[model samples]
Target: MTTISTVDATKFKHVSYLWDDAKAAALAGDEVALFIYRSNMLGADLRLTNYGGGNTSVKLKDVDPLTGQETDIMWIKGSGGDIGTLKKSGCAALYVDRLRSLENVYRGIEFEDEMVALFNHCIFDLDSKAPSIDTPLHGFLPFAHIDHLHPDAAIAIAAAKDGQKITEELFNGEIGWVGWQRPGFDLGLQLRACLEEAAAKGIKLRGIMLGSHGLFTWGDTAYESYINTLEVIEKCAEYLESNYGKSRPVFGGAKIDSLPEADRKLQAAKVAPILRGFCSSERQMIGHFTDDVRVLEFINSNDLEKLAPLGTSCPDHFLRTKISPLVLELAPSEDLSDVAGIKAKLTPAFEAYRAMYTEYYNTCKHDNSPAMRDPNPVVILYPGVGMFTFAKDKTTARLASEYYINAVNVMKGAEAVSEYTSLPRQEAFDIEYWLLEEAKLQRMPKPKALSGRVALVTGSAGGIGKAIAKKFAEEGACVIINDINEERLDGAKAEFVQIFGKDAVASTLLNVTDAASTEQALDNACLAFGGVDIVINNAGISISKSIADHSLEEWDRLYDILVKGQFIVSKAGIEVMRKQGFGGDIVNIVSKNAVVAGPNNPGYGSAKAAQAHLTRLMAAELGADKIRVNTVNPDAVISDSNIWAGGWAEGRAKAYGITVAELPAYYAKRTLLNEIILPVDIANACFAFVGGLLGKSTGNALNVDGGVAMGFYR
Candidate 1:
């Protein structure tokens, strides 16, 4: 099995997208589309993380008719449903209020029991499987769509010693941290309280960290929610992976015995009921043998506690078993008869573990009666014996075993770098009981700068072009959205007007390549509003053509729209900007091809190259005139406009006769940071440049292309 590295630079390049209200509304109103979109998004979210390692949900509440009951419901992805590849049946429907109620009662109950009860309350919408352990977390949120992921990059940083402090320093207000909690009711309560407090204090919460668990993000729309989560995680992951994520250490394992075939079968039968019981009545009966000699030896290791706690990665894993059982470590050819000797040697250890558990329980005793639970250590490791996970149900046992096994492997691999040190023991304890921190989280607020601006975006009809325009509108900008196609232009305008008030947004059909037409459009925009402040020159096209077969006409046609169009619109907007003297911002959507040759698409590449060069020229001349000209070099933006169906990397792999599976790493291997650059990545760059952090950074190329091509200073 592949171990998730603490510093896998390869994991930092993916982009996240969130669905906004408009998109959500579209999905909700269109049953067929909603089905497609929701499933598509779920599948994507799951694949983005590891098995049973992420969470996703959709808000399904609506007002009641007549006798008004604000019955809030959320259709959440079941615990095992991988968001990246979920079906409709994978979601669970839970009453939000009911789920939220668990928080209020949590203080009196142990967190594990409380969470299990809360999960049991969820009623599957369809005849689906049991809900995910993260079900309570989904039911706790008010967002329409919620997603959580355990990205390698984010985990590396979050799992490190002093992780909380480091996360606070890096993400600041843009993200929140919840330390670590066993996934379930307790975590849900913590998250809910955090959201409430954030709202009360007006803390714009962009994302939340579950310490050792993973990351969570939400949006009114699935795209926005997904994207925001992706962006924040990607940012942290990329930063950490580069600077602090890589820490390899050296370690060795001891040898132990393998269980006999007869004993292995007997053990599997013994563990079957335990696994089945924990998996929520699922009768999944398949079982695997752990008779491998290596497994036995490792299980017999003397320092299991020093190796880990409870033989699991995180807590709350008791859902599968009362405890992890150790295999009797013995000789390589040990048979069932050796069990007596193994048990004798380890009997004292078991007794000690039970005594410790009772002591812990005694310390937490209070007036309110608490539910009794199993007193045994949930998991035990014997250096040379194969580990055993006991559950009432096969599925639960399997999940538990898989999780612990993976955790052990990850620890073992991580031990290769540096020994994994979670947040300090006291810190972990504090976070585990941190009700105050839990009560401090709030959903992220809308952008302040975009609250009152009336901006226009060219190419506001499709793909990245429309996405930028829609983003501005969502942030409260009075968008003068435009497109070359009248039909698409009208559709987008209608959508925006409906979303941002008809009075706040407008649309026009104009060919940006036509200088005269653009000039007229600019006048109309000024006449309609006062003036445009942010000019996003995203109106452009690309065509695949080899230089050998390419004609001057092809080059001119591409340039006329990509380069000259930017010039025409920017020139017109600049005059109005100068009159107002408000210091306007212009974002030129350039590509990596501007710096590195695009090979086959010479016409498109040459024009983009010129446009990139001209961006510096404009910056030089426009600085005196109070206009900021910046170019966004997007690399391999995975969208319908490109040949890639899933993403550019995947598409390129197919073109090169390689499997899509090989692309992410292959592309990552080519870059210094091994990151895949996305359009939203460019959008973020534009946001920063337009926000004016660059100060005197005009006439410079910001390397946003995953460090693929670094341009020299002119």
Candidate 2:
């Protein structure tokens, strides 16, 4: 019998042990629940495994629904599911007897991929998710519970030059070793053969380590399996730490120094848009920027040039980060404030990287391989700056950078003790463009209309501005919500963060009338989500007074927020959009009063007229750059309107000789359609202008006022 030892809590420094006895006890007797519990614990720590990187399994006996008899069943994580967020529905249930019977008709290694289709016939539950490619590996294992993890400490040893010899000494012959092979039926057979050979030599092996791969551990019970995995990982980490402490001047010492925090942010802002433009040559992509300590350390190292070209050793790391990264050729001490000079140098670097990737596809692609994907690099490294990652959305871009950081840790540990080895070019290409992987990609849901776009909506804390921001987020756009009211801004941001996630929303206190505040707000948008693609000039104030009663101060205040404020925000947003080299949308929230000659509304009406004309002027001037400028004319949007809340309702009621409670009915009666307009009506008009429906139309005015005939454009 294989001995399972409990790992001492004090022995673990690199990874945490988070198993609670009470939590496990509450989940006893149900094997699937215990399996999910154990998987979540292991996946909670980044030091143990990355997102969607590993697999776990448990075998149990259950009554067959059709046969009315107890039968063996295997439940494992399905393909494309993250272990950290695994649920009961995410597990794929297969008949163990039928799964193991495939060995009788198995052809040679050349026909291993054909075995994947056979696993479908062994499904015990018709509603179970599709089984992962590693299904057979768990099905053929002799243990009742198993865990195959890709921890950094274990991979560091697995990727070293003398990994096999080191594994023999580290576990004292209790663990076995297997050479590199792509995961499939053949790899499962190799694992089974290694276990048999160990038993033949009178050895009770606890686990096995695969070269240039990861670790495998098992036990008779769920708790035993969890503890055994922790023990093996802790031992590997302790050994690596001892050897790494003795080796100083790691990565051959840093060759460059990192920039100061403020300066680094400034440089990153300047370069991120340029990089985003180059990456979006094929399709629009969202970008993420980070100056993490480990990323900066790797960027400043001397061995970066040598090691980065070799790419990542683990399959999970390369799948997200691509086979390799594009390193910018710039000295740490170079003047980074020169935006034009940086773009000039980056042009050739990006061109060269694309050419190299195209060649790689041409050399390694099989006849039936999936077509070459976007040739742009997913990850980019700057010598003095940090790292930049691009993808179809913000979360994926951030995860790609995180996976690359994990690869950096593996490289650091491997180089400390022995030479670090990456997977060969052919093997890396084979896994990246595999047919099964292509099928999985095809199964992903269609992207939303505004999937990779970013929007900046002023005064978004309440009223029409808030509604517009929510709509943008629902359509897959990242939103930067800004307002002058701190209390409302915080509340609005919290609501959006809860619904759309933190990655999709950012908040800033902005006074659009102030030039400095306006520019800084735009800068915040760029830093939050690479650059701004949509700008909604919705911040405003209202005063319903005739020319004789309106003081000069009242007129100035109205013009400052409604007219000049729009100008300041649009001018700043244009600068950033031009830098991104992509067209954008500017939707000015002008009122229907701009076109109507109404009584007791001189100050508000005149300022809105100026804003309306500004939209047309900007549209005519910016058409060459493809930036569309349009106006949304909304009337009597009383519900949740900040303008109405600030004494505007009483003023309008007084002007019409009616009580404040009768304002909604009065406004509705004035419209041709007899309909009461709401904030969502205004929001829908804004979406129609910027939501790609009117992509070819610019310098347009859309009215959402229930057909106000007098306010119609001439």
Candidate 3:
């Protein structure tokens, strides 16, 4: 059954191809650089290509150093290359002649690994990165440069029922159409045949339109290929917008007739956390929402579940996003006006969604098939609330969100000209469970231990605290940098945001001893991310004094900042974790003096000891909730501390009858390891505790003092 959308191609100006820039760079004789520049120029536009979803190649001249022979190798963007920042290292140089060896072989229903091994075997340089799965398509083409991408506009038209006929009419024989097939041996041979067939018919081929997959554009120069890509894509965009669209929603949902925009966005936020819980994998889920008018409208469309069943807009997205999003049956907005109300109403809906997913898998699986994937829903559509996406980690959650937003946009665009035509259920299964895609997943590096977790590090404005926060970020955790010093806190936030990116870092001013301040900070952290999973107790200050000389104020301050503050923060954090229904971690930073006190530091030592004991009690109590509590006690780290930077170090050194600079050496010489215990050492111990290295460890203390004689643990 075919349907028609009244939008037709109207004259829209061509977005000029970056030919001038490419020409200038090529004239300077840097062809490889030209390839990267052209690829990035196209890739930077999300409408043209998505993250990690495109490949580009250029034929580079190579001189054999050992044989003095001249040959050519095509340096193509490799498997893991992200073209946005692609450079020389992102490419794999494959010998063109070696790649031709597997051209005509008959592959009879083979595994994707065999083809991948063949591609790996054809590498011209021993140390070059592995070629991408689509390398053969680029190599077989004689053009000097090739660009392949899954542009939404191009794919929207390619997935329409009038696909090939409309493509021929639009490009006027400039683009060749290749029907959908899993990318491998057969696709490569057919790609070459498609171009040859077009050329033999006296047609000038500019690019290849892959049915239900993507597009491939080629040229004698990088500029020509990149420009052809932009021109054809622009053509598709104009055709959809000018002819069929009466007026598209900002993204692709039906406009909410009853709710105001603010109310709709509010409703989406209220529903986000509930869905996050329902869609969580082994790790808790992170939810991201977008009420792009189009998406909001799409979800509000009459019978959204029926419409969403149209399947993935493009096959490239099948792995990250399943064939169709799980559209939960939402209740009326008035019944679920608040967050708590919505969560309660949606609880049963989530259970039903999972049950259906299991049923779908059972019906789809063969006896020899692999086990079903995690039953958690990755994509969800709801009425009035827009679309929400979930994943085990924040970045994946964000990607899933944007992917669906674009998908809805593309599906609507296709509908503007013709109905959204999708792949058959079996075809979707073939791609989703395809050995090649699975192999790609197997080859990927394991995610960081804390990849999806949220960590809040107190006193992170400097030294030990900053190091711990950095370690968490490196392990893929979203970190919150908390501190009391405004200047230092802002500076640390800027540096962390620069290093780890915007969403991965957040900052808050927290006075650990104040209950209201602690609660406020926790609220902000929860608001930024749906919940807090890990909290680090690192803020402390100590004054050197004899027990008799210690003032009441000095004792109170030590206890307040070091002990009471932790209790306040922990109380607030535990509440959030319990509400989220996931276990968490609390790491307290104590001192070696907790076990072995030095003279004149009675107040500081006692406070630390109390903090350590408190850690044990919390660990024992919270274990049932899945929250782990631990402590890292270190000897003097004055050389690696922000707290010790002022009068404390000077006063301590004076008491020892030595200069302040000699304090680090004094501590180092007393330790058996004779090492300067840096802040990172403490951070590593904390990682061992909360980073899942010692999952069985709780109610324990790890000494990171480099084996101090007095601080030695049995």
What are the per-model C-alpha RMSD values against the true structure? 28.3, 1.9, 5.8
TM-scores for all predictions: 0.40, 0.97, 0.83
Candidate 2 weakest ten by summed lDDT: 1-10
Candidate 3 C-alpha RMSD relative to the actual structure? 5.8
305, model 1: CA deviation in Å?
4.9
lDDT by residue (1-714, candidate 2, tens digit) is: 332244456666778878787898899898889899989998898888998888999999999999899999999999888888888799899999999999998997889889989989999988888899889888888898999999999999999998998899989999899988899988988999999999999998899998888889998888888888988998888888887637666777899899898878777776677788888889888888889998998889999999999899988898899989999887655675565677788889889999999999999999999999999999999888899899999989989988999899889889988889999999999989988889889988999889999999999999999999999999999999999989989999999999999989989989999999887787677666788899999999888877899999999999999999999999988887877788899999998998998889999999999999999999999999899999999999999888886678888899999999999999999999999999988888888888888998889999989989999998
lDDT of 2: 0.89
Which sequence of candidate numbers ranks them by TM-score, best first? 2, 3, 1
Q: How do the candidates rank by lDDT, highest first?
A: 2, 3, 1
Could you give candidate 1's per-residue lDDT for residues 461-564 as a string of tens digits?
66666677666666555567788788988887787767766655667777988887786676556434435678888887666556776678867878898888
Error of 3 at 304 (Å): 3.9
Candidate lDDT scores, in order, read 0.57, 0.89, 0.77
Task: Report lDDT (Cα) of residue 444, candidate 1.
Answer: 29
Residue 4 CA displacement from its true place in model 1, Å = 27
By TM-score, the best candidate is 2
Task: Give the lowest summed-lDDT range of ten residues in model 1.
Answer: 276-285
